[model samples]
Target: MTFRPVKATSEGQFTIEGAGVNLYRAFGFHKPREFDPFLLFDDFRNDDPKKFEKGFPWHPHRGIETITYVLDGEVEHGDSLGNKGVLGKGSVQWMTAGSGIMHQEMPRGNAAGQMHGFQLWANLPSSLKMTAPRYQDIQGSDIPEIIDDDGTKVKIVTGSFWGKRGPVDGIAADPLYLDVSVPPNTRKVLPVDTYANTFAYIFAGSASFRDASTPYGVRVEKEVNGEEVNIRDMSGNRTLVNFDTGNEIVVNSGPDGVRFLLISGQPIKEPVAWHGPIVMNTREELMQAFNELNNGTFIKDQRDH
Candidate 1:
C-alpha cells in the first residue's frame, strides 16, 4: 500500500518537427536512462490547421515502437510494408518498427479545426530489435472504459486494469497506458507496478501529487488569509510527473478536475545508441543503419541476409 512519490515535474517545450508540425515535446533525447524502455513523448494538439496539416512526412524508424493515440482528429498513415490506415478520434495505432521501416503520417483536423493526439516511443530490447515489423490498429470502440460512482473515468488503451484486458498485446514493454479523468475536487489512488518506470502527463487540468498523505481525508485545500500555495507542488496541462518506485499513486484534483495519461512499463536497462529515428545498442550499429539507408537497403526485406 505504499504510495509513489513524485520525483520531479516538468512542462513540455514547444518544438516543430517533420515537414512542419508544431508539437510539445514532453521528454526525450537528453536523459535516456531515466525513462527506461520509453524514449519520447509528443503532444500535437493544435487548433490551427496550418500548424499541423503538413504532418510528419515519410520517415524511417527501427529498434523502437511508436504508439499514436488520436483524440479529436484523424491521422492517415502508410508504411513501406504496404500497411495503411486511418486513426480517427479515440483511435490508437501501435507500430513496431523492428529491423527497419519507412512510414508517413498525415493529419486532418476535425470539424472545429481542432486536432489533438499524442505519440509515444517505446524502446525494444536488443533481442527483439531485429524482429519483424507489425501493426496493431485499435478503434476507439474496442478500447475498454470504466466509470466509477464518483464520476471517475478510466480508458484502458493497453495493458490490464480493473479486471479488464486491453485489446492490443504482444508488446515487448508490456506497458500500461491509461487515460484517467477524476471528478473535480476528488482524491483517487491508483495501483501501479512497483518496479516499472512510471509517469503521468497532465493535459487537461491541475492536480497535486506529494509524498505527504493524511489518513483522515484528501481534499483540495484553499489558501487561508490570501496565503499562496507553492506552485511547485501543482501540475497543470502539459506537465510531466515522474514518480519513484511504489505500488500506488495518489492524486488530488483541483477545483476544475483533472485528466491525464498514466503510463508505465518494465525497464529494459540496456545501453542506448540513438541517432534521430534510428536507435541501436552501439554507435557502430547506428552507423551501419544509416549506411544501409544510403545504399537503398534499409528495409529488412530488401536487404540481403
Candidate 2:
C-alpha cells in the first residue's frame, strides 16, 4: 500500500492560444518529458467570451492524440476528413492524429459566455506513431458516473474505475482518467495500477496528498487520527501531484472540498522528439514530417468527399 508523493507544483500561468484566445497552460511547450506518455495539458476555462470565442483555428497534428473535455459550453469542430460535430457540456473528444490532420475547434458559450474545458495530449508509442487518424466523441450523458456513500463523485472519462468502464477505449497507453470530487474533511483512496505513472491536478479547492515523508523542497503536513492535523497554508490551484510506484491514492479534502482530475497511464519509456503538435521518436522522423507538410502530403488519408 505505497502512496504516491508530490513530485512538483506548478501554477497554471496565463497564456494565449488559438487565434489569441486567453487561457492557462498547466504544462506544455517546455520540459516535454516531465511525465511519460503525457505531453501537454491546457486549461481553457474562461468567463469572457471575447477571450476564447475566436478559438483554435485549423491546425495540423501528427503522431499524437488530443483529448478535449468540455465542462460548460459547446465546441464545434470540423476536420479535413469531413468529420464535423459539436461537443456539448460534459462531452469529450478524443482525436488520434496519426499521420496528419488539419482541424479547427470553435467554442460557443452556454448562455452566459462562460466556457470551460481542458485539452490533454497523450504521446503515442513509436509503433503507432503513423497509424490512421481516428476520433471518439463521448457525450456527457454517455459517460458513467459513480457516487460513493461518503459523498465522493467520480466521473469516469477513460478506462475503468469502481468496476465501471469508460466509453473511450482502445488507447495505446491504457490510461485512467477520472474527474473526482470529495466532500469536505472526507478521505478517499482510489485504486491505481501498480505499474502505471499516476498524477492528480487540483483545479478546485484544496487537498492534502499522502502523508508520507515530503520531498526535499516539499512541505509536509502532520496527520492525527487519519486526518490532516497540521494543514499547510501554501497550497494553491493547478498543483501537480506525482505519485511513486503505488496501487492506490489517498486524498483528504479541505473545508471547501476538492475537485481534481486523476490521470495515470503506462509509460512509453522511449526517447521523444516533439515539435508543436507532432511527437516522434527521433529528430529525423520529425524532419520527415515537416518535409511532408511542406510537400502538401501531410494528410495521408483524405476521407471520402
Candidate 3:
C-alpha cells in the first residue's frame, strides 16, 4: 500500500470576515488550485463573543458548494431561495450554490458564548456549474460514528467508511470527509481512494504524518514531548497539512492524543476562474454571474424545469 506523503504545512493566520467577525482562514482566497475539487476551508472556533458576534452577513455564491459543520454552537442561516434553518451543535449544512444564491449565516453561541464550527468550499464541475441550488442539512445525531477496536473513532460526514455511509450524497466530487480521533501514541492508517487527492487538518493535538520524503515548499517542525523540537524559531498552532498521491495515510499521535479532519476527493483538474464565493471555468462566465447579481436576477429555480 502506497502512503501519502505530507506536501506542506500551513498555519492558519488571524483574519476578519463576515461583517468583521474575527476568525482564522486556514486556506482560501489565495491559491485556488492547490486542492482540486475542494477549494477552500475555514475554521471559526472562538470563545470570545466580541470576536465572532458579527458573524457572516449576506453573500453571493455560485458554481460551488459550501459545507458548514458546527461543533459546539448554533448557526442560523437563510438563502435567497426562501430556504432557512438553524444548525445546532454537531449539525452540518451542505449548500450547493449552483447557478447563484445569496445567503447569510449568523452565529449564536451557547449560553456561555462559546462558538465553534468549520466551513469548507467544494468546487463543482463545469456541467453542474449553473445547476439549481440545493441544500443537505444533516443533524449531529444523524451522522454515523464508528469506533474501531483500536479506540479510533471516525465520524463519517460525506462518504462511506468503516461499513457506513454518510447522509450527504449525490455530490459531484464523491469526497470523503472524516473526523478522526486516535488514541495517544497509537498508530492509525486510513484507507483512501487510490486516485483521490487527500489532505488533513490538525485541530486538537499534535501528530506526525509518517512518510519518507518531505514535501516541497512546506514548512515542517518536530516536537519532543509537546515542546518544539525542530525550528525553535517558529512556535505556534499549525493549520493545514497537504498530502501527495497515495492510497493510505499513517498518523501517530502525541501524549495528549490527536484529532483532525481528513478530507479527500476526486480532482476535477479543470481551469478555475474564482472571484470571491463564485467559481467558474472561464472569466467570461464569472463576469456574467457578477453582472446578474448586479441586476438582481441571480437565483434560478430548477424545479420549474
Candidate 4:
C-alpha cells in the first residue's frame, strides 16, 4: 500500500452564515471540482450559545445532498415534505434534495452551553438531479466504531472501513467517511480505495500525512532551496489536507495525538454551475432554477417540469 502525500493544506476560516450563526468554513462555494461529488463542508463548534444559537432559517436546496453530523449538540430540522427530526449527539441526517426541497435547521446547545457538529454537501450527477427527494436519518447507536490494536479508533459514517460498514447508505458517490483518532506518537496506516480522491481534516489534534521521502521521527520541517521551512506545521487544527491518489494514508500522530475526518470518493468530472444554494450542470439551468424559485415554483410539487 502506498501512502498519499499532502498536496495542499488549508486552515478553515471563520465565517458567519445562516441567520447569523458563527462557524468555521473549511471549503466551499468555489473551485467545485477539487472536492468533486462533494460541494461544501462547514464546522459549527462553539462554547458560547450566543455564537451559534441563532441557527439557519428556512432555505432551498436542489440537485444535491446535505449530510449533517452532530458531535455534541442537538439540531432540530424541518423540511417542506413535512419531515421533522432532532439530531442529537453522534447522530447524522442525510437529506437528498434531488428534485427540490426547502428546509431549516435550528441548533441548540447542550446543558453546558456547548455545541459542535459538521455539515457536508455532496453533489448529485446530472442523471439523478431531478429525481425524487428523500432523507436518511441514522441514530448515534446505529453507527459503528472500530478499534485497532495500536489504540487507533475509527468511527465509520459511510462506506466500508476496516471490516465494518457505516449506517448511512445508498449514496451516489459511494463515499468513505471516517472519524479517526490516533494514539500520541503512533504511526497508523489506513487503507483507502485506489480510485477515490481522498483528503483529511484535522479537528482535535495535529498529525503529519505521509511524506514518504522523509523518515519517521524526524522533525517535520523541510529544506527548500537553502532554507529550512516548516511544512508540516500547517497541519494543525481545522487544517484540510488534500491528498494525491493512493490506496492508503499514513499518519504520524504528534505528542498530543491526532483526530481527523478522513473522507474520499470518486470524482464527478462534470461541469458545475452553482448559484447560492442551487447547483446545476450549466449556467442556463442555474438561471432557470432561480427564476422558478423567484416565481414561487421552486418546490417539486409546484413545478410544471
Mind giving the per-residue lDDT tens digits that candidate 1 earns over 1-305? 89898899999999999989999999999899899999999999999999999999999999999999999999999999888899999999999999999999999999999999999999999998898899999999999999988999999999999888788899999999999999887778889999999999999987887544542124445677897543334679999999999999988887789999999999999999999998899999899999999999889874312
lDDT of all the models against the reference?
0.91, 0.85, 0.84, 0.88
Clashing pairs in 2: none
RMSD of each: 3.0, 4.2, 4.3, 3.4
Q: For this target, which candidate reaches the highest lDDT against the unseen true structure?
A: 1
TM-score of each: 0.94, 0.91, 0.91, 0.93
**TM-score of predicted structure 4:** 0.93
User: Could you give candidate 4's per-residue lDDT for residues 1-305 as a string of tens digits?
Assistant: 76677779998989999988999989999899998988999999999999988899999999898999999979999989888999999999988898899999999999999999999999999998887888898998999999899999999999998888998898888999899999887878899988787889899878887655664435646778988865444267899888888888888888789999999989988999898789899999888888988999888764322
Q: What is candidate 4's CA lDDT for residue 212?
A: 57
| Candidate 3, pairs of clashing residues | none
Q: After superposition, how far is residue 209 of candidate 2 from its true place, in Å?
A: 0.5
TM-score attained by model 3: 0.91
Order of quality (lDDT): 1, 4, 2, 3
The segments of candidate 3 whose C-alpha lies over 4 angstroms from its true place after superposition are 211-238, 303-305
User: What residue pairs clash in candidate 4, if any at all?
Assistant: none
**Which parts of model 4 are misplaced by more than 4 Å?**
211-217, 220-234, 302-305
**What is the C-alpha lDDT profile of model 3 across 37-112, one tens digit per residue?**
8998888888888888888899999999999999998999998878899999999999989888899999988899
Candidate 2: residue 63 lDDT (0-100): 87
